[model samples]
Target: MTTAERATELRRLHAAPELLQVVNVWDVVSATAVAALPGTRALATAGHSIAATFGYPDGEQIPLHLMLDMVGRIVRAVDVPVSADLDAGFGDAGETVRRAIGQGVAGANIEDQLKPLDEAVAAVSAAVAAADAEGVPFALNARTDAFVRGRDRSLDTNIADAIERGRAFLDAGATSVFVPGMFGEDVVARLVDGIGDRKVTLIGLPGVPAPARLQELGVARLSYGPTTQRVALGALQDLATSLYDGGVLPEGIRPLN
Candidate 1:
């Protein structure tokens, strides 16, 4: 497709009525699979996925240049719109959002993580402004870490904080509010309901529930967040072990790599 066509598709996707089952792809190969899926309307990349793939940790271990290069590869390998997890925006929010748009991503998941909630909001707001300045219809997934954080706050307190942070972030021009690490059904429902038709999303980790279950929970979108790479690596390890220890290929076996 032409550049204008691609941009139009990416911007129009957020308006989709059906819940988007966005998988976290780490490389060109997985991005290709996700792009080929009939149900896949967009692609999301994980920060931890880039860290693990590059033999680093998740705390911004992979630099922006490297991550942007990998993102470019995946974008080139797929036709769908891509939204990347730019963990903590890797710096201030404005530069983070601008750099991501510079790399051709349609959107980014900016979290109120590792810093005061106010700073996170400021950062995301700056990012949104930057993206807008560039004439890109940037979608910012405002993520709160009240539950995801290892703080000693009670669930009630954390929920309150998350809701408060969610409201502030949304007011700061966030395209959507994403409450990651809220895994419980009841908790998910509360967050989704709290956001209330403002295009909220949740991180639906694998083994949490069936996709139908998430859809039933009023979730507008779901992101896997790099579990697919771990799954694939484990499967590849087992396949190699079968070739080494089993001493024979199983029936109808073919190359996994």
Candidate 2:
């Protein structure tokens, strides 16, 4: 599909009755491996995983060019749509999203990082404007750090803050509002009710409700962040331990790449 077509497909996926489950990939190999799955319809890049691959920390620490370069390679490697985690937009949300569109990214996640409400809304608008200029539907997952960064505050306060920011973001042209921290069913329900059904995205952390349950709760999308990469590394570590313990390479290992 063309870049614009892919972006439109991503938006449609988000609006589908079945929740969109995007497996986070960091590079071409990982992207292709996941995209090869029968159920995979789209991909989301984990900025943290990409940064770690280059020995840098997350939060836009990886140089913008390097991040975009890797994301571009992943885009070229897979036929499915890709939604990149362009964390905090690398200090220039508009320009970063424009370049990501140029790389053929169908969507992106831009975190507010608890910035002032007005500034955060502006960032969302800027990103949307850039995508509009590029003529792509660009699923901009505007993220609010209220829950993640407001740990010291009361749950009610954080939820309220998230709902407020989420509404503002949606009004400013975000495709969905990503609330990243873990929460119970009640909290999720409140968010869905407050933010509008099927307009909230979530992360799939350990112990979170199953995707089916989350879909029932009206979530639009669910993405595994750096956990996917961490899980792969954990398997590698287990293999190394077995090898050191006199075990031969396991049989039936398929070359995904």
Which candidate leads in TM-score? 2
Q: In candidate 1, which residue pairs clash?
A: none
Give candidate 2 misplaced runs (Cα > 4 Å): none
lDDT of 2 by residue, 96-120 (tens): 9999999999999999999999999
For model 1, how does the per-residue alpha-carbon lDDT over 115-158 read when each residue is reduced to its tens digit?
67768778878987898798777777888777788468788787
Q: In model 2, where is the ten-residue run with the lowest total lDDT?
A: 202-211
Q: CA lDDT of each candidate? A: 0.77, 0.95
**What TM value does model 1 have?**
0.90
TM-score per candidate: 0.90, 0.99
lDDT of 2 at 114: 98
Candidate 2, backbone clash total:
0
